[model samples]
Target: MNAFEEEREMMLRVQQADFVVVELTLYTDTHPEDAEALGQWREAIKEAAHVRRQYEKRYGPLSLLSVPTEQAIELGWRWNSTPWPWQR
Candidate 1:
């Protein structure tokens, strides 16, 4: 595939993850007895985590909705404490 096609594919995968999260949340809430659905939810969550790590490695950190991107900021704390989005 060309670059455009590759980028489109990546965007589609991202959208799929978003859709999966919504569906899994509703499914798990409504049908608590479905082990398979729960397993799917776990897989979707793992996928989201993997995607997050990939983006953080390639690009900068994606700060929380409450916080802005910290790419332009300096470290304000010790080594034990990272920026807000990355803090443990």
Candidate 2:
């Protein structure tokens, strides 16, 4: 796939992972003893973090919250110049 398509697919994967984590969290809240669900939720969270970091490293931070001040300075405040997620 081309660059844009690849990026889009990565974004979709992150979104799906995040959704699964959220759903599993709610399920685990009532079924606190469900170890399997909890483990699955943790894995989903890790996957989301990994995918998000990859996306940020390639396309810039997804939001202000995702950008550390030191890293932003190191990058010369390029976030301002980069397009927003929707714009992409």
In terms of lDDT, the best-performing candidate is: 2
- Which regions of candidate 1 are displaced past 4 Å? 1-11, 65-88
Q: Please, what is the TM-score per model?
A: 0.57, 0.82
For candidate 2, give the lDDT: 0.80
Q: Which candidate number has the best TM-score?
A: 2
lDDT of 2 by residue, 1-88 (tens): 9988988988898788889888998999999999999999889899888888888777767777787745566776565574766577
Give per-residue CA lDDT, model 1, range 1-88, as digits (tens).
Answer: 9755654555566567868988998999999999999999999988976765554433345444312334334432232344433331
- Lowest lDDT sum, 10 consecutive residues, model 1, at 71-80
